[model samples]
Each structure stands twice: as structure tokens, then as C-alpha cells.
Target chain A: MNAADVLDGGVLDAARALRERRVSVADLVAESLGRINAISGLNAYVDVFGDQALSLAQAHQTMLDCGYDLGPLHGIPVSLKDNVDMAGVVTTAGSAILKDNVPVADASVVSALKRAGAIVVGKNNMHEFAWGGTTANPHYGTAGNAWDASRSPAGSSGGSASAVAARTVFASIGTDTGGSVRNPAALNGVSGIRPTIGRVSNGGVFPLAWTLDTVGPIAKSSQDCAVVLQAVAGHDPRDLQTSAEPVPDYLAELERPLAGIRIGWIHDYSVKDVQPAVRTAFEAATATFESLGAIVTAVAIPDLDAIVDALVVLDAAEPSALHGRWLRERGDEYGPDVRAQLEAGFVLSAVDYVQAQRYRTHIRARFAEAFRAVDAILTPTLPFTAPRIGQDVIDIGGRDRDVHTANMQFTALASVPGLPALNVPMGFDAGGLPTGLQIITPAFEEGRALRLGHRFQMATTFHLKAPPR
Target chain B: MDETDSIRCRLRAHGIRETEAAVGLAASWLRNAARVRAVVEEVVGPAAGPVTAFTHVPAGLHGEERRERR
Candidate 1:
């Protein structure tokens, strides 16, 4: 297959091709690296080490020739968000403060992916400290939506999401603090999952909020995410917060039918002013889910707004707390916007901090109750189409709404509740920007959400659609 | 009405000095509670003092220190 055809194949197909000796790891790695260079205009990567990737791919090929199976991702080239530590590499988190910060070891996730035989092609850019919703970084230039260069790729995982969407990398990992992973995934037209906080270790990844920080995959398909997740998910004693709960075979669960699953749709979370096209596309997705033997229910999640608010507050507070000193002494070192938000975090009170934690505990129960009645919750990943770069707002239902808040509306909720939400491309909006239908399930129930999302994608043409390369 | 400002003052009044250049220590700790707390009140409605997780840093820094010790 040609580069375009190879790039379009999902991770499993590509891996199966490599496993069966139909494709060379060197070829795939070279193609991905070439695309990354060609799409340098997208600013999707923080750094790309083409030589290193080729070396790793060759090493894996050598092992396979010796009848050695490294793992599921033997020859796959995977990009990581810059915030993740990769031993010899600097982890900037797209910030100037840690621009020179290098690690002596790889993050658990990076280590796991490497152990599973995935090639680390490069590090993707992100909003400073994973703070903002829009990936317009003052430090690293904003990563444009692959399909529409003029539009914003949602942040702080924007670069990772954009890279995958742009076919610059087979798949990339992004941290979802508020809506970092899903918003970018939605806007850039890809699949990403913010697995339950403790379900995935946060050992070496930069922290946005210890309470809400979870590392997840931004991939071309839920199946791809499962492949990536298998390598990354598991308890690391290093992360005391990681659950001892058994990690299921996520890929095996992906093939299960979605029949009789109860899915809840939140029209309110859909936002009051979603573009008519987005709403119609989202509804069509819901109808598709309904047709697949899944019962769609509209359920009100109590304290939904408060939960999102609490999550934002908590997310802001923790990062600010973790990075507060660096910000104070070297405030100029940060990107202007990240510094501003971190400064805002410093202004919150101790009571407010406690309240956010208490709110997290209080709000999680409400979602738990809702999940008892439904297998998953569904909403649009983003309420509107992607906005133009430098366009900080959009006209929503006649009102020009702030992009950050609007982009985060549906996504922040899942963070607060600590649930697993999958962002699957639904269709383009009026602007031809990709829109995603977010599927959320009870904490650690990524299986249910993935099964439902996989089925939905199987019945729809959206996942098969691609950005103009 | 200025919740952000109230948080600011609270962080200041309580003397939450940052350990590094990146964070403000105290105020940064409270953001999520404020946002989620507001919604909790909206959804659950009218929480008494018991439902609130806040323990006022007593009039003195001593009280705040003691509270932290807990």
C-alpha cells in the first residue's frame, strides 16, 4: 500500500500487516516521519527524532526475524505528548519553564509502550502545563486542525490529537486534565479516551491535577486506542494512586456486541447553542446507537455544572500548587496565557480548594447512581465547529461565546466524575470541521464505552473519513 | 460576588507562599472545590455547614497551621 493507504489503516491493521510480514517496519516508520516533516506547518510535534525511530523500528524487525515477538506494537510508530518523560529527551509540556528539563528514565507509559515494541517517533506539542482548552500556545505556536488549517486544534493535547488526525503519526498519547485529550480529539477528528484516573498510572507524566490527571491515547480508532491502552494500562507501584483492580483485555472486549446496552444522552451537556449541523450529526449518532440494540436514555446527571466547575477549579489549583513556585520566581519563563491561568490558580483560597475536593467526592456519587441505571453517558465532544486560529470566540445561538468554555463544556464533566469517555468522530459541522460523539461510562468501564463506540463507528462512515492530506 | 477575588484574599490572608515559580500554593489548591461545590449546591441544593469541606483557617495562622497538621 502507498503512504496515504498505509497511514489510513487503523493501528491493528497496520500491526497485523507488520506481524504477517506484509509490510516493513522501516517503511511505515519512514512514511510517518516523512509526513511529520511534510506537515511541519501544522506544528503538531515538539520534537521528531527520525534516526532514533528508524533505529528502534529496525531493532524490532531484527527481533522478529529471530522469531522473537516483542509485543502487539512491534513496528508501530507512536508519538507521545511532550509532557511525558522519555529518558534522554526534554519534556517541555510545551512550556518554557521546563524547556531544558531532561529525565534519566522514561515515564511508565513510555516505558510500557517501548516494552510493547512501539517506536517512539516524536513528542507532540501541548498547551503550557496542559492548562488551556484551546491549543493556542504563546510558546509553541498553535497546532492547526489537520482538516482545516485556519481552525484551532483543541488543547492541551492539541498537538497530539492534531498529529494523529493529520496522519503525522500512527497514534499519540495526550494528557487529559480538563478536556485536554477529548476536546482536541473531537476538534481534530480522532478517537481518544480519558481512562479513569487511577486505571492508568501517572508516574512520570506532568501533573495538571493529581485528582484528575489521567494519560490516554489519541488514535485513529477505538480499536487503536485499545491496542495502545493494553500497553499502557496497569498498576505501577510508583503511582500510589493506581488501582490494584485487574486490567482486562481491552482489545478482546472491543469485539463484543453492543446489544441491550443502556446509553444515556445528555442534551443539556450538548450545550444550548450547538450548531444545527453538529446537533443533527450528534442525534444521528444517537439514532445509530439506538439501532444497534442499544437503548438510548436521557438522564440528568446531578450537579453536572458544579462538577465541571469543581474539576476546573481543582485542575487549576493543583497545577498552580505544583508549579506555583516556578511560576512565582520565573513567571516570565512561562507562556503568557499559561502564566495567567497559573496566576489565577494562586488567587484561589484554601476553602475553595477543599470545596473542590469535597465536590469531587460529592459529584462522583451522582454519576455512580446514574451509571447504575445506564451503561454509559453520551454527549457531543465539542458543542461547536472548530474556530479559526486567533479567533477566541464563536457565534453560538446568536451569542459570541468564549471558545475555551464552549470547547470544554461536555469534556470537563467526565474529568470531574472520573469516568472513561471515548471521543469518536461523528461528522463534519457546517464548517466541515469534524465533530465527535463522546461516549462515557462508569469509572473503569471503558469496555462498555469502547464496545458501544466501536459498534457505532462500524455502522457509520465517519471513522473511515479522512482529512485532506 | 467575586469568588475569584475571595479565593485570592483567602490565599493571601492564609499566607500560601509558593514553593516554586510556577504555582501560588493555596489558591491553586481550591479551584475545583469552588466550581464543583457551586454545582453541588445547585444539584443537591442548600447544603448545611456539615456538607461543606472547608475549615476556616482560624483567625490566626496558628489555627491554619493546626488545620494543616490534621
Candidate 2:
């Protein structure tokens, strides 16, 4: 099969075709690189591995010819967020400070993807140091939204989501700390799964908030995400944070029936500061869940306001500590928002940081208590749709607020507690932007979230609906 | 000293050159910290035992630290 045919079929489809010898591996990589170059205006990629990708594909094809099965992701084109290491490539983390900081070894996640015979198409652009909600990086040109060229792709994982939405790559890995990965996916109308903390290794991935950080998949659909997860989710010796817990067969669980599954709808958390469009879409999503034979019930997690406040402190403080010396010496080199936030961290007392951590312990325990009663919790992935590029302030729910604060409110529900949260495309709002329904499962239970998401997609055609080309 | 002055003093002590916006953000976080503590007190109760920070790094990885502490 030709490049165009394989490129249009997506990651899982192309992988199947490659295994059957219906499509050439080299042809798929070439098509992915061509698409990357064609959509260069989106600023999705900071670096394109055209030569390396082709070489890898050729090698994988030879292995396939020798009757060697490399695994599910064999011959698939995948992008890594720039923060992730690719050995020889400079892992910029979208910051000038780390502009020339190349790693001597591939990140553990990168090794896993390579082992699965996946070609690293390029390093996707992100908010500098994965600090901001919008991909409006001052150092690198902003990553444009796939749906509308002029709008923002809510990020730190903006480019990854944009690339997936535009169908440039089958999937991309992005780190989530306070809604980075899932935010971009939600805004761009794609599947993004932030697995529970320690479920996936973070060995070579750049840290934002070490305690809250997680590497996750941003793909065309939840099933595609599961395939990627199957390849990458496991205990890695390199990352101490990776739990010894066994990685479940995520793809196998996707086909399970949703009948009798209890989905918790935290009414207080779900409705707070939610935009009218989002509220409408989320209500419809819950109704659809009920129709699918899943029992959806309203539940509560206490001290939510305190939890949000604690998250802000922890998120800001950790990055501050990570970038403290740089902020002191090269303060002017950082982006305005990042620099300001870093400086704000220095202004915080260690007492405040400690208090936030203490609060985090309290919040996690509360979530643990709530999860015992339900299999999954449901909420809107974002409070509102993607905002216009360079738009910092927005009127959400009739109250003006910082765009990042507003975008993070719903996604943070999962992030703060470090749970497995999956964003599935629910439907489009009145403004034509996609709305995402978030399904959050208990820690280390990614299969539960993916299964529910897969069932939702099977019942509805939302994930299949492409962005307006 | 006033709140702004106190914030400026704190920033200076931290070796961060104070700007109006940075000071403002700092003061805001300080306010948030107070509110957070209040909520924690309300929910978990005062005289609450100190909770260690959330960390996923396994204890085995901190063997060196444990040894050093001993």
C-alpha cells in the first residue's frame, strides 16, 4: 500500500497492514515525515527525524521479513514530546536553558517504544519546560490548534495533541503535571490518558512537579492509547517511581462490556465553574453512560477547594525548585509566564510548600476513600473549549479568570490525586470546538478507564469524527 | 510593615529581585497558603499530625539516604 493510504489509516491500522505486508514500513515513515513537513505551520515539531525514521523503518521491515514479531506497535510512527530524550537529539524541554542539553541515552519510555518497532518521527513542541497551559511558547513559535489554525491547543503537550488531531503520527507521548497531557488532548479533540503516578516510568522525561508528573499517551482513540500503553507501561529499573505492580493487559480490557460498571459523577466537582457549553456536553455524556448500562451516580469528595489550593502550591513550588538556580542566573532567558511563576516560587516560604504537601496527603486519602465506592469518576476534561491563541484571560462561567486556572480546574481533579484519567471526545460545543468527557479510574487501574472510554467510543462516533480539514 | 512591604522583604531575603508583579504573585500565594492551612485545620482538625510529602520514589531507591541518616 502507498503512503497516503497508510497515513490515512492511522497507527493501529497501519501497524496491522505492515504486519500483513500490505503496506511497507518505510512508506509509512515517509508519509508521516511528509505530513509533518506539510503541516510545519502548526509548529508541532521542534525537530524532525526524517533520516533516522526511515533508517529505523527499514531495519524493522528487515526484522519482519526474517519472521520476527516486534510487537503491537511494530512499524508505527510515533512522536515524543521534546522534553523526552532521544539520545543524540538535544532534549530542549521547550526552554532556552536546556537548548543544547542532549542526553547520552534514550529515555526508558523511548527505549520501550523502539523495542516495539515504533519510529520516532520527531520531537513535538511544548510549553517551555512544560510550565504553561497554552502552547504559546515565546522561545519556540506557538503550536496552533488543529481544529482552528488561530486558536490555542491547551498544553504543555500542545504539539503532541495537535499532531495526533491532524493525523501526522499515530500517537505521541506527553507528560502530565496538573493537566498538561490531557488538557491538550481535550482541547484538540483526541484521546489522552494520564496513567496513575508510578504506573509509567519518568526516568528520562523532564520533570515539572516530580511528585505529580506522569508520562502518558496522546492518540487518535482510546484503543490506540491502550496499544501504546501495553508497549510502554511496565516497571523500569531506571525510574524509581515506577511501581512493582503488574501491568494489566489494557487492550484486552477495552473489549469488555460496560454493563453494571459503576461510574461516579461528582456533581459538586463536575459543575463548579463549568462553562455552559461544557456543562451541556458533560450532561449528555453522563446520559450516554447511563444508556450504555453503566450505573452513573452522583458522589462527593470532601475538601475540594483546599485540594485545588494545595495543588497550585505544589505545582508551582516544585518547578521553582527544579529551575531555581536558572531563574536566579538566567531569569531573562525564560518565558514571561514561566519566569513569573518561578520567581513566585522563590517568594514562597518552605513552610507553605510543606503545608501543601501535607494537604496532598490528605487529598489522596480522601480520593482513596471515594474510589472504594465506584469504579470510575466522570467530569468534563476542561471547563471550557480551546481559547484563542495568546488569550491569557477568559470569561468562564460569567467570571473572569486566568485561562490556565480555568482550563486546569476539571483536569486537576485527577492530576492532584495522581489517578489514571482518560479524556474521550464527547461531542462538539455550539462554537464547533470539541468537548471532552474525562473518565478517572483509581490508581493503577488504567484498564478500567480505557475500557469505559472504548465502550463509549463504540457506542458513539465521537472519536471517529475528525477535525475539520 | 504593610503586606506589600513584607512581601518585598521576603523576596529580598530569598535573593529574588522583587518586581511589582512577582511580589503580587508571591503575596497571592501567601494568601492561598493561609486559606489552605485553614481548610486543612477544618477538615483534618487542628493538632493534626504532620503528613510527609507525597512521593512515589520507592524506599529501596533511598537506601543511601537511609544509610546516611543512620
Candidate 3:
């Protein structure tokens, strides 16, 4: 089978083909490498593990021949964000300073993916140190949107989402500190999930913000994300923050019916500042839920705006602490945007960080209160669709707003409370850019979010739609 | 000195030297952080403790065992 034909069906479909011996693991790896090279202009990858991937694929193929199966993701080709470590590979975190940094052992998540028989083809490009939303890497080239080359694939998981949208891989692991995974997934017109904090281990993954950092999967559909999540979600002794809660059967949960599910639409705060097209798409998604027998209602989150603001302090301070030594000794090697943010972090007083943490507790209680009336809350993933590459400011409702702040508005709502949020493509605007509907569930209730997203994908073809090649 | 200079001095105190333009950017970020801090302090009372988690100690490392060892 041709590469396009093999990858077009996504992880589960490809898994079926693999089990039936229609395509060998080597074939999938070769096709993924070819596609990565073909779309080299997108800058979707920082380093391609061509030979190493093929060798691993052959070993997996050998296992299959010997009547051994490693489960659903067996032999599936996927990529990892640059910040995720793969043994012997340079984990640059999309920065120049760490270009030569190599790990002796795989990240716990990488080991999990390997144990599940998933092939790691390459490392996706990201915003340097994940301090920014745009994947306009100053060290590695900027990653372009799969839908429109001149537009951004909202980042720091830009390349991961772009590669998935472009069908270079079945799925890619992207980390979220403040909506890094879901934001890019939304802009790239794919399905991505930020598993509740601690649902997946963060061992060996470079830190952005310790409290909010999470590893998640971006794929063509929620079911595919579930498969990836199933492989990676579990306790790791290396990561003390990882949850001891049992990892639920996410794939099994996807089969659950959407009937009678209480879906809350955060109408006031979520819809107040969105672009017209995004708002329209959000309404349509809400209506689709209602049609699916979900009881959709307006839910108010009074502290939403304040929580978003407080997140900035934590995002700035925590990462600054991690990068303090580097910023002080070798600051010039850092990208301008990341360096400035790190400098800003140094200026924040300890009281500011403490206040932000207190605010996190305050806002989490508010979310818990709202969750009492609803199973999940819905909002537009971003206030606007993917902006033009290199554009820092965007016009929303006739007022120009900073792109970074606008991108995080809806995403931070989930991040502040470490809630599980899924970004599912709803529809496209007139310009053909996709709009995403975000489903935020209570902490450790990622299955609810996945079930809602999977049902939405089953009812609509938005997640299945590919960008024009 | 102005706010930008004040921030530049702070950055220097942290051993980071940047150009004038970068310092200005850092100043804006500092102002933004300050604004967020103010909003958070307004809503969060002193009675509310910071959201912090202590690292998990092993089963036998604490309490009676540690007391017995001492």
C-alpha cells in the first residue's frame, strides 16, 4: 500500500492493517520518513530517526511473525515533541544551547510507547523551551501550518500537531504546560488531549512548569489519542508527581453513548471575546451535542478571567526557575522571546508566585462547584483560528489583542485546575482554517472528555478532513 | 532611573545582560506579572494557604520509623 493510503486511516485503522499483515512495520516507517522529507518545508521535525526507526520496526515485525502482539499501537509510526527524550538522540527542546544534549535512557513515556510497539520516527519542532505559543523556532526553522503554509500551527506543540495533520505520523506526543498540546492541535485541525495533570508521567521530559506540565497525544481522532494515552498513562517511580489513581480504559470509554450527558457551555466568559467565526463554530458544536442527546446548558465560571491571569505568573515564575542558571550564564544562546520571558521570571517576587498558587486553589474550587452541575464544560479551544506566521497581534472583535494572551484565554481555564481537556475539530471558517471545540472535564476524568470528543468525531467528519495537499 | 532602567538593573543583578530592546520587553512582562499578582492578592485571603505539594515519602521513611531511628 502507498504511504498515503496506509496513514490516511489513522492509528486504529493502520493497526487493523498491521494485524492482518496487509502492511509491514517497515513499510509504515519508510512511508512516514518519506512524508517527513516530502513536507520538509513545514519544518515539522527537528531530527528524523530514519535508520533507528526502521531497525526497531523490523524487530516489531519479527515479533508479530512469532505470534507476539504488543496491543493496539503495535508497529504504528508516531513522533515526539523535541522536549521528549529518546535514548541516544539529541533532545534540543527546540533551542540552540541544548543542540548537543543527548539522553542515555528514554523518557518514561517514550519507554511506554516503545513497549506498546509504537515507532518513534522523529522529534517535532517546538517553541524554544515551550515559552511561547507559536512554533516559530529561532534555532530550528519555524513550523508552518498544514492547512496554510503562511499560517502558524499554534504551538509549542506545533510540529507535533502539524505532522499529525499532514499525515506524517499516526499520532505525536506533545507536552502541555499551558495549552501547548491542545492549542496546536486545534489550529492544525486534529484531535488532541491534555490528560489531567499526573495522568501521564513526566519523567525525562524537560520541564516548562512543573505544576502544570503534562504529556498528551495529538492525533487525527479522539480514539487514536485514546490508544496513545492508554500506552503512556501510568505511574512512574521517576516522576513523584504522577498520580497513583488507576488508569481507566480510555478506549473502552470512547464507546460510551453521549445520551443524557450533561455538557456545560461556558457562555459568558468563553464566548465574550472570540472571533465571529469561532463563536459560530462553537454554537454549532453545542447544537451538535444537544442533537446527540447531550443536555447542553450555559454554565458560568465567574473566576475564569482571573484564573487565566494568575496562570501567567506561574508559567513565568516556574520556568524561570528552571532556566535561571542557563539564563544567567549562557543567556545569549537563547531565543529572544524565551530569554525575555526568562528575564521576566527573574523579576517576579516570591510573593507573586505564592499569590498565584493561592489563586490556583481558589479557582480550582470554583471549577469544582461548576462541575457539580455538569459532566463536562465546552468552549472554543482558541479565541481565534491559526494566525499568520510571525504575526504577534491579532484583531478580535475590532480590538487588537496580543496573540499569546488570546491563545491562552480558553486553554488556561483547564490548565489552572489541571483538568483534562480535549480539543476536537468542529468546523472550518470561510478562509478554510479550522475551529476547535474544547471539552473540559473534572480532574482525573479524562475518559469523560474523550467519550464526548469520540462521539463528536463519530457524528462529524471534521476530524477526518485533511488539509489540501 | 525609570522603570525600564530599574528592570534593567534587576536583570543585571540576576547576572543577565541584554540589549535595550530586550530590557524593555522584560519591563513590560514584569508589569504584566505585577498586575496579575495584584488581581490574585485581591481575591485570595491570607487564610488561604499556597497550593503546594510535598514530595511523597516512602512508607517506612517517616513518622514512627524515623522517630525510632533518631
**Model 3 TM-score, all chains together:** 0.95
Answer with 2 or 3, whichever has the higher lDDT: 3
Can you tell me which runs of candidate 2 are displaced by over 4 Å? Answer: B45-70
Docking class of 2: incorrect
Q: Write the per-residue lDDT of candidate 2 for residues A7-111, one digit (tens) a residue.
A: 765566777788788888898888888889988999999999899889988998998989887887888899999999989999999999999999999999999
Error of 3 at A323 (Å): 1.4
Docking class of 1: incorrect
Please provide, for model 3 over B1-70, each residue's C-alpha lDDT reduced to its tens digit, 9 standing for 90 to 100. Answer: 8987787787778776756656766666666666667766677677876653322322221223223221
Please provide, for model 2 over B21-60, each residue's C-alpha lDDT reduced to its tens digit, 9 standing for 90 to 100. 7777887777778877887767774444444322442232
Question: Compared with the true structure, what per-residue lDDT tens digits does model 3 show for residues A1-469?
Answer: 6556988887887888888888989998998999999889999999998999999999999999898999989999999999999999999999898899999999999999989989999999999988899999999999999999899998999999999999999999999989999999999999999987778999999989999999999999999999999999988999988878788888888887888888888767768798999999888898999999999998887656566677788898898899888887888899888888887777777877887887877777677677766788999999898899999899899999999888988899888877789999999989999999999987767787888999998889999899988
Chain B TM-score, candidates in order = 0.32, 0.60, 0.59
lDDT of candidate 2 at residue A243, scale 0 to 100: 80
Better of 1 and 2 by TM-score: 2
TM-score of chain A of each: 0.97, 0.97, 0.99
TM-score pick, better of 1 and 3: 3
- Full candidate order by TM-score, most accurate first: 3, 2, 1
